[model samples]
Target: MLLQSHLRSVNPDATTIENAAFVAYRKDATNPDHFIPVVPSESIAEAPYILHLLPALPPAWPNGHIEGLRARGGCEVDVTWRNGALASANVRAPHGGSLRLYADGSLSKTIRLGAGETIAWPLP
Candidate 1:
């Protein structure tokens, strides 16, 4: 399964994502030691899965930036960014499923996806 790299951008361009399968990042974008890529264990069968990579571990910080991520499925999500910082996301899944949203500071949320439904998720 491959995910589009442009999903990482606050303002995605027309460039298409190709030949990539993993979305990678660091808990702290500035900390090279914490870099990790998010790889889904199973092929996405329901919602189009996309990730919003926050700028910092707490994510509530006033500053941060975007990181690259990759995944599969055919759901389009609109990510909301505030002043170059991560804020929230609107997600939709075509077949319905579940996702565990995670943050660097042990913060996580389990979202239930309904078929052809859109869900909005806010970040801390």
Candidate 2:
């Protein structure tokens, strides 16, 4: 993925930071994946980061399950599983967050913290 940013224009007062573009691409020919091109009418697209959390057991879960968490900016994700497994991660900007898979698929709870605030989501 390639990202580019530039200053489009500056007013007399120089109070506004106008027009930014984010270009995503895959250079490898083996993995040819293309994103929906953004036109002048619609310049900006908001792509949210998603993490999949799944059980680590054999046979029952192969690719694991999708975790319904949309992360933005800098945040931390804390995961707790039923099999006494605990994991925590801090996410940085410029690159999307990381996806942490717990051994025990049965997650008890997940906590997301950002900017001195925390949101807790319980799983079934």
Candidate 3:
């Protein structure tokens, strides 16, 4: 089967085939037997939306932005996950400071942390 994969070629002018033809050998390898090619799904046309990245850096590499779930102060931090789900954070956020979190690539919550806070989340 001719499976046309949607790989981006650097040279756009490159041609792989001018026509589609299938050659098969019969009983004594004398002639051709014909069949057709089928594409199972339209999903092959392009990559899915998330053939990319998981949004934030883990808590060890704290980015002090709302997009990342890390400490905003001079506090130590740790993040934990279980079975691809966010489990908890060992955060020492200063009073009135907040921790941000993402779920399925969207900003899910922003939590106000008391000093020496340990926070947890339920898995979906």
Error of 2 at 87 (Å): 12
- Tens digits of per-residue lDDT, candidate 1, 14-114, equal 12222121345436577866766665445423322324344244535454333223223445555546654446655566776554332222223445668
- Write one digit per residue (lDDT tens) for candidate 2, span 35-107: 4543332322232223233223344333222232333344344443333232332233323322211222332
- List per-prediction Cα lDDT, in the order shown: 0.42, 0.29, 0.34
lDDT of 1: 0.42
Stretches off by above 4 angstroms in model 2 are 1-45, 54-72, 84-114
Residue 57, model 1: Cα distance from true site in angstroms = 14
| TM of each candidate vs. truth | 0.40, 0.27, 0.31
Best by TM-score: 1
* Candidate 2, residue 56: lDDT: 34
Residues 5-117 of candidate 3: C-alpha lDDT, one tens digit per residue:
12212222222211111122224334345444444344322211111012344556332222233322333344555444444534455543443333344332334557756
- Could you tell which candidate, 1 or 2, scores higher by TM-score? 1
Winning model by lDDT: 1
